[model samples]
Target: MLRLLALRVLVATGFAVAPAIAADFPPRPVGQNQAGIGQDVNYRIEIAAGPSSLPTVVGPVSRIKDIATIQTARDNQLIGYGLVIGLQGSGDGLRNSPFTEQSIRAMLQNLGIAMEGGQARARNVAAVIVTATLPAFVQSGARIDVSVSSLGDATSLQGGTLVMTPLRAPDGDIYAVAQGPVFISGFSAQGQAETLTKGVPTAGRIPNGAIVERQIEARFNDDEVLTLQLRNPDFSTAIRVTDIINDYTASRFGNRTASEQDSRTILVKRPASVSAARFVAEIENLLVATDTPARVVVDERTGTIVIGQDVKIAQVAVSYGQLTVRITEQPQVVQPAPFSRGETATEPSTVIEADQSGGQVAMLDGPDLQTLVAGLNRIGVKPDGIIAILQGIKSAGALQAELVFQ
Candidate 1:
């Protein structure tokens, strides 16, 4: 009974002294501030909380974007195999890469050069895979970037040019034609005993190199409803997004236009009088307040720790400090008396020292992220120690947020 009373008194004293230290502890700014000529505004904290007594912050709030609202449409991939010409002894070897030689012969034959019997000797050419992304709603004659990669052992494509290559979609239909000067970002060279190389010369890109020859006409007409897909799955965010969109355009549409189909997607009923394009435009302009859950993400390699504002802590005490150990080697040589015919000898000696910091213990009244982190920092918690402390808190049921490690 006496021991228990003394332990209670010690804990009470720790609580009183800890808050004073916490008051003196300076918080390290986690974000960068821009140096601009503008007045600093007081923004309300928009953090979401669960059923707990987590501390609340009263400063600037972070804005979140609905990923689907900003995206217009998706792009399609078109691929084809063709040949590159005008290489300086960096072309694919015909003997080793048979497919390169076959492709070269086929393209040459199409250009009215009959290789029926004779060897179509083209050492300065290379077989390549041509690829491009056909952007959504791209019309015929529009240009896009294309990538050319050597299909064989080509040394360099410094000044090479891609031949007329037909890019086809999964349906085996030609959609675009690519032909441009290759922009190789690397080179290769061989010396007597050394070799120097930079960026990859075998694979290069041609900006605005392909011309679309066909178009896929799939317009978001008023007949069909448009679906909004969430980049990250969150039920609360999804429902809030649906309600905000409906509330904004409910009067104009005479009915709710948006509904949460699931956690990852939202279905918006196309207003008959308003076109789908117009409905999407209006939805994009409106901002939906986000209620993001608290989560702590840590990058172990770089020792990066990011804490959410609503991260709560339970009544727990943490004590931590730095430990240092040092060792030194010393040697002593012993010599015999000058008159005595004795050999000299050497002796080894060592000195070791251990030092530890005067770490303190503090009772964390974690109602919010600020006080919780401040208390830890006050006790000399370093980056490495912070990681361990957070893990311990989660294990001890003090931390009320998901701990994600990367």
Candidate 2:
């Protein structure tokens, strides 16, 4: 019985040792490593050569707003000074912020209040700067949103109302006037000696705060000729657009070169027999094939990597390891001799330590996308790790696609 018990213990020890030895064993493939893993070659081949035509669907003809003339497709910024009133003692102090006081006095004077001096101490109003964008083709009386930010030392703009203020474009033109109740996304509460804030209290937004008072002219087809512009100035896309339009026109009219200043603008000569509006409508509905650049976008802040379907990497081997360094700073004190005039002092002693673990060099034979992903996963690398690996690959000239860091 004693011999049998000893044999059982020896077998258990052998079983425990087997796993540790297996962990250090070199990696081996269960099957032959080859191309076309988890992919159907027959389907891929069919898609590559099958169709050059797009499906026809009924939709609105793309207009100028849907696309842009490259030159006119830009946003305009507007800024103006405004007042936010009705705050419950959360506004700027009159003594600290003189501008707030001046603005309030001016507003009151405009309402026919005759003050002894040109100054007033008010704690219920804040001087704010309003900013907004005047979109293209805005009509008269159209309402738009505006953002209000405190220009003074105001603690918060909560429960405030914006006075009438004119929003001006960069060209010094007053396009819209804003006036509404401000809605602050944050709140503040204060005790006798302390205060707590949840979000930014100095900025707020007013929905539909501005009303447009002027109209910007946007008239197409006024002349016998018009132009169609490409959003992205690609020569290939421009040629394709021209071809698609010409095909729809049945060669009745041909596009002309108006000027050398802009290559995107192609003049459309109106046919003598057809109405210009009808002809323009037919050209906008035409669909053509578009090609995009092969790109891989990485956002380091969010640790996101967006890889385009056409992105391909060249054959390469990647190995990754981590190095951690620890440093400790301990301060020591030295005491002077008893009855000595010298005072005690403190000294700092810094000890820097480093630790490097043995890292396994993962052999990656990335011939295609599937193999590349599998190889990266084997090393326990996630999105953040992949970001670092991609940066390294780009530096080493192993990545083939354009690496864009956003």
Report, for every candidate in turn, its global Cα lDDT versus the true structure.
0.71, 0.65
lDDT of 2 at 361: 66
Show the lowest summed lDDT stretch of 10 residues, model 2: 1-10
Model 1 Cα displacement at 16 (Å)? 71
- Misplaced by over 4 Å in model 1 are 1-66, 69-74, 86-96, 114-126, 154-159, 184-204, 301-304, 315-388
In model 2, what lDDT does residue 199 have? 93
RMSD (Cα, Å) of candidate 1? 20.3
* Pairs clashing within candidate 1: 54-367, 55-367, 55-368, 186-199
Q: Clashes in each model (backbone N, CA, C under 3 Å)?
A: 4, 0
Give a tens-digit lDDT track for model 2, residues 1-406. 0000001111342321111100111211223222224643221101112122544423233443344352222345667888899999989898998878777777878999866854566788998999988676568899999999998888899999999999865444677899999998888899999999989889999999999876455433333455467675544444545545555555545432121113354445556666656766656666655444557899999988887545666656677767779989999999999999988999999999887653656766555556767777887777988898888877888777789998
The worst-scoring run of ten residues by lDDT in candidate 1 lies at: 1-10
Native-structure RMSD, model 2: 25.3
Q: Which segments of model 2 are wrong by more than 4 Å?
A: 1-76, 170-173, 187-199, 223-233, 251-285, 325-375
Q: Please give the lDDT score for candidate 2.
A: 0.65
> Mind giving the per-residue lDDT tens digits that candidate 1 earns over 101-220?
777778767888877675555678888888888877688989999999987888888899998999876545688999989998888898899988998878999999999998765444
- Measured against the true structure, the TM-scores of the candidates, in listed sequence, are 0.65, 0.66
